[model samples]
Target: MTLRTKYLEPWIQARENLERRDWLSKDKEKEETQTLIDKVYNALGSISWSANIRGFSNTERTVTLATYCTDEWLSDIQENQMLDLLQRRLQHEPGGQQIKVESVYFYILLKRGYDARHFTCIWETRHALSSGLGPSCIGFLVNVNRNHWVAVIVNFNSRSILYGDSLNQEPPNDMLAILHWWMHHHTGHRFTTRSLEITYQKDAFSCGLLSFNALAHHFLPMEYPLIAVSNVRNGRLKILLDIIDQHLDQAGVRHLQGRTLLTSLFDRASSPSVKNISSPSLNPKPLLTLCDQKVLYLPKARLG
Candidate 1:
């Protein structure tokens, strides 16, 4: 049977209206909402969490995900922290121990005058390279001057860098050169750079998710599904849930489960438009394997 536009239009409209509006309580007073928020914050205990997650402060996590509870561009700090969390998740997955995820800060440090030699020092301090922990695959989420985000995967087995950009654009030449130089300097071999044909994001804010999914697909394909424009809202919710799940301890999880307010709040906030419609199946097109090799050269301009 042919699909009916009449039946599908509202669903499409609902996806477009992705922002959650009912964050505050609708009852006589907003006491319930405030209480729930406080509970979440208390469980998080930002000071201790920051010490554990390196630098991802409590305020950064709660403010970014709690305020809107909707699709939004991840901030630099959020993305980096999320990357660290994802790396933890990946390592636990079967066969994921072979993969290593580089911090977004690595790229940031390079941008701030660090060189290939500095990476050698960094790897030493992190105890990644010094301890004979040779990962077959390495993932990098590069932030291009706070303008755009991209994922670059260094596959040691293939001796290649797989580039993923949701905007269907090439990574800047200088950035590629830096990566190329880093690989050759550390491993003593030139690695080929190739682009991955990832699904193009239809909206602006989903770049972070897309870049993240690129790494997710490479390391833990079955666990973390690929997301594009169609299911990006659900994607956002899934990520939020994952973050909350990872940080919450058994006691905290039980505390959250004991209350209905938090669940109700998430339900109300996430399903703003479509109350009855189930989420669409997220089947994405197969990524094209054929892509031109990107030959890079070190730029004359020095790192700054």
Candidate 2:
């Protein structure tokens, strides 16, 4: 049987069945929902039997799933942080309800008798009947032995509801591309690239999509050429190095020439003594001293 047929279809049908039943109270409904979620996870665990068969155990694995509910669903609650903002929306405003669920599954897959933990996020698509626009969710698959994780964010909203095929447009920013390029350039491990779906509403930003990677996560700044690239991209190469210099100075990574130049420039700009030595002849001694110290010097005269 196909993976989806074996795994997802049954789980989805079970969830649908649970949702169709009328519960006495909201608490009971919530409990039923939780039970359905548990059942789905358990079914998923069974379907992913290879994960356990390969010396991988549930003791070292954990999955976290965060579900974002629609405004209408949220309004049913007595008090919520997002309630006030939802109430003030104009009537014409798209009242479509969307639930985005992001799940990060961490697995400890053994390699050569050594245990390794990997993290992955997965995406799932679900639609609410009240809101015509379908919702997208995230899912993850982690392989600890491979030191890799895969994350997928599915976008289920109709093209008209979103950006009318703008969702399929090429990326405007080069950040992820540059990051991927630099990663492969240095590590020699061909990093697979995928685009994540991100959504913005007014001032709020949400990660509606994600790209999956099959390599261990590395600290971005620690990678050399990439760090340089990022610094240049942020227009902070000079400033960052300067700050690093200051830090290094505090850490005793002192360069005497740099320190001297900096201090001399600062003193020349701020010192009161420079004001007193302004006159060419009256304070010739101080002027000469300044010249001797190389604090003040004239440029070479150009011949016409």
Candidate 3:
């Protein structure tokens, strides 16, 4: 299906239909559906903002299901209680991680007394091998009312850090380029998809290479060092950074900073690494990256 028909139209319809529904009567069945519709509307609003940054201009881009639960019923009491639990947990946590949004969504639903679950999917090019390549796209599949719901949550886990040294394999060129563009525009760090190629002569490993988009300012201690290589040929880009790390300290910092080390291989025939290397060949120069970060400059009360 076209991206518009798949992602944008459905969400628009869902939101409109949701806004028109009456929920004050509290009929059990209608209320249940209303709750789900509310969640879907809110989730879509979140997804749209997220996708806008990734250069996905088409509103029809659909959100894939991640994981979901259908057995439990939702109630206000349960939802409020869960929200309290989540608020307390987040109090001790650091901000800016991708999963934080997901956690917030999960807690919001729970606090609102809805039974929900999470599911993830990856968007892959026709060339990607189905077996081992990680999901190109990932998001949660929520059980709203009695129906299933899908909403994209880009940047949900995009901040994972990858070490610069000890890379062994290559990743898909497009993936690296997009990611590089995203990190630089969204975050303050200026990193680049340096190169992607094959390595490990004996076993013949395909890897994706990336480095800092721009070297750190001389005065700064280099708070974040960019380094990542993924095995796109074999479809194990998700674990690329962890495998190449020489020290847990470096790797740990990257992981905590939410810098991504994973790569997506959308083609099976050409090693993902090969795709990365050849990207510059096909496209004269890298496209100007779009900034995905949304800065909320208002006070807390103003936000609501």
Candidate 4:
């Protein structure tokens, strides 16, 4: 099947970007990228041709991911959906780091009501507290007036909440109030809150991508630092490829062999996008680092 025109351009642009960046120096690296692109192309073709795919299964989710990979912005809810997938992967990590990824809806619900009973129930019902104790840390994204996105990570280990905005703006007061109440309810005391040092977005429409990067920056033990703002386009492409790679793996089609999406990503050792930052380090042993859609550490303990 012919790759759709919409998808064709993105893949072509991705190939061009890879070559222009000189990331594919070796023949093996070039071949690997081509194979990965072919798989993404095939996946895009499959979903475009499939019938009656109404639900947001792995296959259906590909549509949203494909759009994102092509440098389009996604809704707050869509960002949460992608985060949910990453949350699942994080759970399977080998370490004892217990992390909770809250949905944008979770924040929405907080806005509607601050009932302690209601939230406590919701937390328990959703298994937010795995061992009858809450998770080590809770991370979530906030949609600022439905216009821009920001990432907030509450690290119980450090007893601090890091608010990350690519625009370097202060967090909304109401949102901070909700967080203050929520944390007190969970821990019997207020935790400190501060702004996380984040890469500024050079362009609009990349906050969602940067939000993902922020989460990875504070939690995942990535070999490199946070992705630079200028490289967010490439970041989106890598994210889309990671989503496609996982979808193919889940659907039992992992034959195409070479460097994994992240492996290939790190191949660009000289790319300025992999700039370092001074932030709290996570357990350097996460079985899976956030491939694109991106941890926290705390001891197991009962909530107060």
lDDT leader: 4
Cα lDDT tens digits for candidate 3, 58-176: 12111221001111222222222222322333345453121221321442333232222221221121113233233222222222232212122223124332322113434334334
lDDT of each: 0.55, 0.25, 0.26, 0.57
Write model 1 residue lDDT over 1-304, tens digit each, in one string.
Answer: 2121222222222223332222423564345434543444333322121112222333342323441234456766566666877788876778778887777776666554345356544555235533557788878788876877888888877889899999999878888877787676667789998986466788777788788887777677677667646655456555654565565541244243232212322233433333323334321110000000100111222110
Summed over model 1, clashes come to 0
The digit string of per-residue lDDT tens for model 4 on 77-182 reads: 4576557655766777754247877777667776555744366435562355334466777788888888898998887777788999999888888888887877
Report the poorest 10 consecutive residues by lDDT, candidate 3: 259-268
Query: Once model 3 is optimally superposed onto the true structure by TM-score, how far is the C-alpha of residue 263 displaced, in angstroms?
Result: 32
Ranking by lDDT: 4, 1, 3, 2
Q: Which ten residues in a row have the lowest lDDT in candidate 4?
A: 295-304
TM-scores for the candidates? 0.63, 0.17, 0.18, 0.63
- Which of candidates 1 and 3 reaches a greater lDDT? 1
Score candidate 1 by lDDT: 0.55
- Between 1 and 4, whose TM-score is larger? 4
- Per-residue error for 92 in candidate 4, Å, reads 4.1
Runs of candidate 1 with Cα error greater than 4 angstroms are 1-61, 112-132, 250-253, 256-304
Best-first order by TM-score: 4, 1, 3, 2
